[model samples]
Target: MQNSTCHLQPSLATSVALPVIYSLLFPAGSFGNILAAWIFLKQAPTKRTQYIYLGNLVAANLCVCSTMPFLAVYFARGYQWTYVSTECKITNHLGTLNMHVSMYVTIIILCSTAINQYATLKKTSDTQYSQAINENFYRCVLKKFRQPKFAKQLSTIIWLTVLCITVIAIIYNAKEEIEKDSKCYSIGAEANETTAGIAAFVGTACFFLSFTTVLLSYYCLTKHLSKIQKTTCIGEKHLIYSTVKRNILVIQMILTVCFLPYHIFRPIFYVLLTDRYCLRLNYLVEIKNFLTCLAAAKSSLDPIIILMLDKTFKKSLYGLFTKSTPENHQCKADIFTEETSKM
Candidate 1:
């Protein structure tokens, strides 16, 4: 017996909606990430731990931006592409790979930053960075993560691990072959239906791991900040810690708005997209695809987060537009340096 493939009929609404969604997403994501990348590269290398992760996050965003056009075109053509062709494989692979990689990498980076922020802020008014927090072994362990060297190492490891897993997953979960009655761009190949079940479970687990970690990080950090703010008078140090605390919240917001829905839908999509419901719920394919598109929207959103977290980048951005004198810029730079050193 030959293998059966997914043959869900692509609907006009989905066909129209995808291209429209991705059309807007492609240019916006690409332009935003490119501008962010330009600003990042122009700045001098620093010992800041946060910049390293932010840079890596920008790279991941660019990867998502780079793949958007091909995806837009694929959807614009109403899923007419053949599964057997190299273009299809490449587009599908890069699109899905970038989406998953970008989300997980963003998740890991945010989690790390959250932990680092907590570690930095957990110190008493007069205590050294680790001395106050050392009572909690976890906070003590974050010492390395606060360093630039550790950030670089962690960024490299995250990218390599995510890429390797994504490659393996694409190879195993998708076998894009067309038979006489099979459809090319359905949810997945019908013969390998079990793969979706496994992938859904795995994906959801990873998602919750990220979600919980970031959630707890936000809660703990905010709680600590509230205590400090209540007792301390208004000052630059309070401002610094408060900024750090707000950034953690920003990362948490990004995680919730972008990645949460995709994870929530995956298990349901997998279960319902089986033989029992696949043909009946043809539109489910597009709904899943749209959510995937929404996950990728973070590529555009990340640059704003970068600006929120990194004052240096923000200054440089403003300086470009405002035409400040050299001495003025230098003074601002010095002030920034002083503030950064205090952290």
Candidate 2:
């Protein structure tokens, strides 16, 4: 009986676990992203392109963080959630929308960083890199993509689209079986709908497409790094090569840890969510729920990642917590200088 049918009974995962996890993640994400925002916003003049990407990333994380308290409220209710309320639907819609936006935007920004690395390594000289920036129409478009204006414009478009979608979902939401089960986030009988299925399919497709592009870039970057390693004449610039390689690898690792599991299982979970899949496979829904939480947890982890990945940001963030003293400042400078020389 246990082998043939998985238990659908309530457990700590839905009732107690999610809220607890959300509680832990909320403060971490808030503190980290807030620091990140201050850092990026202040440095816009010097590093406009990086600021645009990372600033948006911080905004996306904050969006997720804002939704967590409400979601934690819902999940904490647990077995009591027999019927969905208007508030439930609204919370569900807001959480779902923010999660997807965060995922998609992070995917693009991280991939762009990798793609830029490939572009950087492709140019044999500083002259080539500078000349390559506006060499032709396509390059011009790519160049525009890296600018602050384009990021602002695109961010506006994404939020506007999300506003439209949220309205549609709220107005048109029908009570499907899964929603009746108080499982607001899962893809179930709704998957049978052409419109919903198409949306799900498109999202899954986009993730894999972006994943492939990043993987290809990572491979090419590795080859370039290897070539750089074989030459001893690069001198101090070898640190740049090492940093680039580390960043690319860390980006891939972050994607795998934060985003991969949910994406990998989403399609299968989508099918299992339908009316045809039966209650026996209901356990998969719990698995999917945990993965969803993990995806959301990326926001909480982003600040720590930012601290590790960007030294200037790390120093600035650390400064916020420490006493501001000239001797301490000199000590930090000396420490950084020593680390840089060692590297």
Residue-pair clashes per candidate:
0, 1
Kindly state the number of residue pairs that clash in model 2. 1
lDDT of 2 by residue, 4-66 (tens): 222245467776898889888888889878878986665323334445566777887898898
Per-residue CA lDDT of model 1 for 89-174, tens digit only, reads 67767765566666667677777877777666654343645455667677667677777898898899988998788878787645
| lDDT scores in order | 0.70, 0.65
Q: What is the C-alpha RMSD of each candidate to the true structure, in Å?
A: 3.1, 5.4
